[model samples]
Target: MSKDPEDRLTVGEVSRRTGVAISALHYYESLGLIASERTTGNQRRYPRYMLRRISLILVAKRLGISLTEVQHVFDTLPLDKLPTAHDWRRLSRLWHTQLEAKKREIEQLERELMGCIGCGCLSMKSCRLLNVDDELAELGPGPRRLDAAQAA
Candidate 1:
């Protein structure tokens, strides 16, 4: 069966229009983040609507969202149509909440890090005042004091 040329885009065409590399488009397909059809000659042919999907993927990546997360969201949508503006707004709201929580955690870590630097010590474990005879060694690895404080 012949696909209407206007409704389908070649790999190169998609790359040119979306500014995503051909290899990255293939990688996205491999991850199920996008999909394409093979022409009778085995060339890749993407639906024209995939341009919008690629844009959404690029936007999500720029926001530091992992491909796995993008795939999870994409999996929830119908594969036959472009995502609507409502979909974009819903995702934006969800990501905003998540990013805000991450910002707060980073700010908290910054405060803790400043305290650690105040003593002019390079090693928290070896610091005379903080570790005191390697007492934290018994608590296991990592920033035990910070971990404990955060837990509390």
Candidate 2:
């Protein structure tokens, strides 16, 4: 790691280096997704490696993680310590599990949609192909003429 005193970055420098907007950086800070220190002038300063942290925030946002969830993930890290490679690897393992679960959910929804389309069932209550519920009350009443017998 570079130990040059000049290597420490200001918030503007981090924003320039990461190509992330300064407002987004502030938003990340407000969400507790990232951290910074205030200089004597009350300006925010960040470590040079915060570029990586901001990048991780962007990636997590793209993955559909809520800001609160992102904060929870960051909360697990040491407040004063920059993340090490081992820390990143551990986080990535958890992220992989989350991504896998999301993928399975999408696949399940796709299957359900396909079944509904194939069965020509537009009403949730009567659609055996799409409705996973065992009782009619599972879906609030609207239209119920979607049974296979009705289709026939």
Candidate 3:
């Protein structure tokens, strides 16, 4: 919010402003999702712009996006300034397809979960009535029946 491009915030100030813990900020830095400069006294100081990145990370987290994915998208963003509305739009567009696929996967799993509730045994050998001598194994690992159902 400061007009000064040199405006910087201490870790505690950033934490208070963003409602993020200082440790989490450090973790984000460690993961390369965010960065900071060290003072001569060895304290971390973040540019005011990093608040936007942290906010974006929190939103992505709530949407079930991984930090790796966030970092991938963030690689395209400018680090010296707050991301514009257009930048945020682009980020959302990038994530839209991934989120949709994840939604469909969750829906399919929910449907299959109901079907499995009675048997509850997803074992290849024990679920002979459904798996029938592990024939599904030939297709590879995971819930082959569920995956097959989805394919259908």
Top model by TM-score, which number?
Answer: 1
Candidate whose lDDT is highest: 3
List, residue by residue over 2-102, the lDDT tens digit for candidate 2: 34546567877888888889899888888876777766888877767777777777777788876776687888886556678887888778888888998
RMSD of each: 7.0, 6.1, 7.5
Q: What is the lDDT of residue 27 in candidate 2?
A: 89
Question: Which pairs of residues have clashing backbones in candidate 2?
Answer: none
State the lDDT of candidate 3 residue by residue for 1-152, as single tens digits.
34453688999999999999999999999988888877789988888889989999999999899999998988888666789999999999878989999999888767656667778776765554466557877898787777878999
- Roughly what TM-score does model 3 have, to 2 decimal places? 0.74
**Full ranking by lDDT:** 3, 1, 2
- Could you give me the TM-score of model 1 versus the true structure? 0.77
Off by over 4 Å in 3: 1-6, 119-136, 139-152
Clashes of 1: 0
Superior candidate under TM-score, 2 versus 3: 2
The Cα error of candidate 1 at residue 104, in Å, is 1.3
Give the alpha carbon lDDT tens digit for every residue of 1-152 in model 1. Answer: 12677799899999999999999999999988778888889998999888888998998889888888888888987677777999888888877887898899789767666777757775767654566568888889899878989999
